[model samples]
Target: MSNLAPSLTAARQLADEYPNHKVTLLLLTDFQLFDADINRVLTDIATFPGDVHAVVLGGTQVDGLMDERVQITKATYTDPPGTVARAIFASLVNHRPGARPI
Candidate 1:
């Protein structure tokens, strides 16, 4: 969602600070340079102590889906923001049981 640098930094910090907490990151933006950075972040998060889940909303190509520890969701701006959020939330809740925040 944020720029690559901030996103990575935040993810690292969160993973470090709250190792026992479940962490989910949502990246929603458009950039051709995000692939490598996102991959690195995901790798780091997966190695963190807690459970880390990431949903990438605007990626073009993803190479690691069978890893079981990380997930990547590629989405475009084909609908309104509200619709997009709903869809993302639905998918997340479906894939990750008890992930929805009420």
Candidate 2:
């Protein structure tokens, strides 16, 4: 899905449901695909304690969205999944070595 709002909400819900476990969300989409206010999405993402990363296709990166929790990539049609995988792997290697995805 283009919008991250719904996914973010679901991730938050999952986190709430499993308070003792880690909750992570990986979102892949085209840039500017948010159906809700970008500010609200950003706020939700920023406040989220669990991991959240994104691979966004083709658009200027939002100023505040590339923090420790978010990774946006401009995916190419030829290898969108590869692009996302690389982004996720890079984030993991750089940020949390030896960590496995949940």
Candidate 3:
């Protein structure tokens, strides 16, 4: 089963409890600022049993960290929400076992 939680702590707990299933933590926000702690969050997600995908919904910043495993697509101005949702769906569908879908 897939688990979608808001907080990282909760997500971690879920991951620990369901070590055999996939746990995805979706963060829906505009990419305005890049947080330094994002690295830690990514690290935690990587340790999960299933694939971890982050669907960022926002405009790409110039200084955003470029991770080959993380896929970052530009959300269209006309329908940003829909674009984000589609991107997340695509990520989930394309995600492979023991691999990170970026």
Candidate 4:
């Protein structure tokens, strides 16, 4: 989806439906689609019970996007498949335990 808020909202709603399980949201993006609408969703996501990890493709890291609540990794589309996978894996491994990467 082009809009980040709606996608994240839907994910949050889906997680709400299954209250017994912890949800993990793996958001892969190029850091190019966000607008003002994402701010509110970010606020909500801060309190979300599940884990949120953003795998930023193309190495285009957005300023102010990294916060204590969300895990983020920077990888390039030009990188080899295994390199990207290792970067993602390392990021998740360093994240808090019990989170299932999506």
Best by lDDT: 4
Candidate 4 lDDT tens digits, 1-102 = 345777777888899999987677777777676556666766765667678777777777565865577877777857667765765665555545775544
| Residue pairs with backbone atoms closer than 3 Å in model 3 (clashes) | 69-102, 70-102, 71-102
Stretches off by above 4 angstroms in model 2 are: 65-68, 77-81, 88-102
Candidate 3, 1-102: lDDT as tens digits = 112223556767777897666555544445443545665655554554444455544455623453444445656476635677676766665535565533
Best-to-worst ranking by TM-score = 4, 2, 3, 1
lDDT score for residue 71 of model 1? 48
Q: Among these predicted structures, which one has the highest TM-score?
A: 4
Q: Between candidates 1 and 2, name the one with more favorable TM-score.
A: 2
TM-score of each: 0.50, 0.65, 0.53, 0.69
lDDT score at residue 12, model 3, on the 0-100 scale: 73
Decoy 3 TM-score against native: 0.53
Q: List the residue pairs that clash in candidate 1.
A: 1-27, 1-28
lDDT of each: 0.54, 0.67, 0.53, 0.69
lDDT of 1 by residue, 1-102 (tens): 244666657767876797665656544544344444666655554565543444445655545532466545456666446655664575456536667733
> Which regions of candidate 1 deviate over 4 angstroms?
1-3, 34-42, 45-59, 64-68, 79-83, 87-102
Q: Output the lDDT of residue 45, model 2.
A: 78
Give the Å shift of residue 55 in candidate 3: 2.5
Candidate 2's TM-score: 0.65
Instruction: Please write out the lDDT profile of model 2 over residues 1-102, one tens digit for every residue.
Output: 367788788888888988886655666666565475877877887778667666676654655655665655566666745666777676565446576643
Clashing pairs in 2: none
How much is 17 displaced in model 1, in angstroms? 1.2
